[model samples]
Target: MKMSNLAVDICGVKLKNPIIAASGTFGFGEAFTSYMDISRIGAITVTGITLEPRLGNPPPRIAETPSGILNSVGLQNPGINYFLDAELPELRKYDTAIIVNINGNTIDEYCSLARILDSHPIDLIELNISCPNVKEGGLAFGAHPDTVYEVTKAVKANTKKPLIVKLTPNTSDIRETAKAAVEAGCDGLSLINTLLGMAIDIKKRRPILANITGGLSGPAIKPIALRMVWEVAQVVDVPIVGMGGIMDGTDAVEFLLAGATGIGVGTANLVDPTACVDILDELKDYMIENKIEDIRDLIGALRI
Candidate 1:
């Protein structure tokens, strides 16, 4: 691996780069191992896991839109027990950091999952309060400030590992949601989860997704994600992980400028399996071109 000024320390966890494969997009970090070197990227957030195995939403779960895509996969996973028994061992083979994204329908469920992962080999536990695909507990818990605080506090109490609260864009005030999570004791924050969106098949006169509505991801939400990250960064003292429509190094750089300690690649992974590695290379090139000695110098460097 060619060395560069891309190393970063997010909440005491060191990353070779700032680019991570966002949750829900990267399935346990196995699918892309053949296409590219997984260790080259900063980190990988596995698919969201629940207390029990989920069959997920019905078919036609994805629809492509202008500059983005909408998905309502519904947090399909083989449950945490299966993950710890089967997936975690295989994922640990890679040299990259493994951060698991966990989802639940209740505060107790969230705490349970956190406690289970606390003693495991995973490097971090990302709370998925922002996922919009589920009917309950996912976005429902994240939409309100009080519920966000309660759930975050509950999970933080159960886990010794670093906790990162993923924030939803559907809420009335993302700042309030971020503040609540921070106050509740999250060590870090990631924003923004896909925006609520829908697509209709005009020929059939119905919605394209079986769930009626899905979360919008990709380039379309970058501006909103950057704005929210900037807003939360101003109010919170913990590190921020910025994501949404980040397709290239420049987009990742934009997030860092807006005050993100790290960046995540989501829909871009669906477009090209090697997107994360490619973006990291480009980031290094940018830093070299700018004569920047350290990537950390770019974090929160955006000037009004």
Candidate 2:
């Protein structure tokens, strides 16, 4: 067995590699055990969990677009307590970093969730500020810098665990949100979440998703995600976890050059359950072929 030394220190969590399973894709980490070597993954970020279990939206929760997927899952989850009691216990059996991705409807909700998980034996906590801001009457917090900082600061007050604020790409200025999160004491950043989009059934003249509008994810959003990663990298000092429509080793490398310390595999996992592990393997090959000894050497290596 050969080790390629692709380790990364993300918000104090030292991962064996730089490839992570994007939130809301890999389930609770146990789901990937049947298809791939789960331990090879740098981390497996669970699906977005709220305070309570949610059945999610109604039928037609997903719409297949030209080159991507539109999802209005309504932040469905098994709930935080279920995760802490059952899922977390199962994940502790493995050595891979277990990242808990959380969402809330209000600032106090964010704070409560953070405080609840503060004592858990988890490696990191990722704040999904992209969730609907109930105080704003359903506007997503990540769409505005003020709400972004508010949620981040609220959560920071409750937990000592590393907090990584995940940002959405629908904002007017992604850099402003990144700066806001960093100033609020976020240990890291992850972007970009799904872009706001809607698909309409021309025959019926109605929206495809149950919620009418859904977040667009996959290859179609890759260009936009990469651009945000580059822009946010210049303004924020924290490590960035970049993902949008990454499916292969090449996409991972592109993110690294864009100044991301790590890359998340989202829609790609649905395409191939072993996506993250395979990406890490391909990354190792790329490093050896390029005469690079460490993966960190490739981060921000891009030049004009």
Candidate 3:
């Protein structure tokens, strides 16, 4: 079958394939270009960007679990201005869609970043609502439906580009936040951000991560990610980008079957720089073996 059959669209943004390099792992797509052809993958969601540059957490911010890793990277980036001026121009030369992942400490900061990116040539805006809300007593904006709606609506109003809200899994009900985002005018949703977890340094008699806790990701979280994506897909009418512990082509297929219109490869990238394209190739092979004509046929095709 032709590779063109792998094409898929997310929130009106066309991707060559359903495989997207998940945020924070791909590092703006430039780092992987040396390992493989970056253009072969679908879209690229750069590292989480803030209004200002961050020094990130102190040392020992990452620890390896049985099948995954815990990370408290603290949203370190060169800030949006540096990204637009230094990174985005080079990223534009590539053939994949550019999804800028933006984070803010307050609602107004989110809105301001949206307005600033509105005039840029980026293909999509992914709101990283997992960031702590400074104005709301240090709670993540995505933890509650009300705050999710408030931030989604505020950011939506400030930008004309298609907005994709990345939902945090550290909530009581993931479905509610998904519904809240769509109701507030979000064009699409990405589910199953890292689950709250930590590692203890048994020898050191202390927590491994400096923050005492971090986001857990890897094959260990795939089951939870798939369940959340399937649940959210049942309730929301918008497109869903499913990510978490996706380490290979089979993992990507599972997410697609679970109702992800787009598959996000996260921890897998850190394991292998060429993981995105490799997963895309494996997905194409799966389609050929299954005689699937189009990649869209796999979306929500799970046997219930």
Reference-based lDDT, residue 180, model 3: 96
lDDT of 2 by residue, 37-111 (tens): 798889889988889887777879889997899888777788999988888998888879988888777778778
Report residue 19 deviation for candidate 2 (angstroms): 0.7
How well is each residue in 127-234 modelled by candidate 1, as lDDT tens digits?
999888998888999999999999999999999999999999999999999999989999999999999999999999999999999999999999999999999889
Q: Which stretches of model 1 miss by more than 4 angstroms?
A: 1-3
At residue 187, what lDDT does model 1 achieve? Answer: 92
For each of the candidates, the C-alpha root-mean-square deviation to the true structure, in angstroms, is: 1.4, 1.8, 1.7
The ten-residue window of minimal lDDT in model 1 covers 1-10
Query: Which ranges in model 2 have alpha carbons more than 4 Å from their true place?
Result: 1-3, 132-139
Give the candidate number with the greatest TM-score.
1
Q: Between candidates 2 and 3, which one is better according to TM-score?
A: 3
Q: What is the TM-score of each candidate against the true structure?
A: 0.98, 0.96, 0.97
lDDT of 3 by residue, 183-230 (tens): 999999997788889889889999998888888889999899999999
* Top candidate, metric lDDT: 1
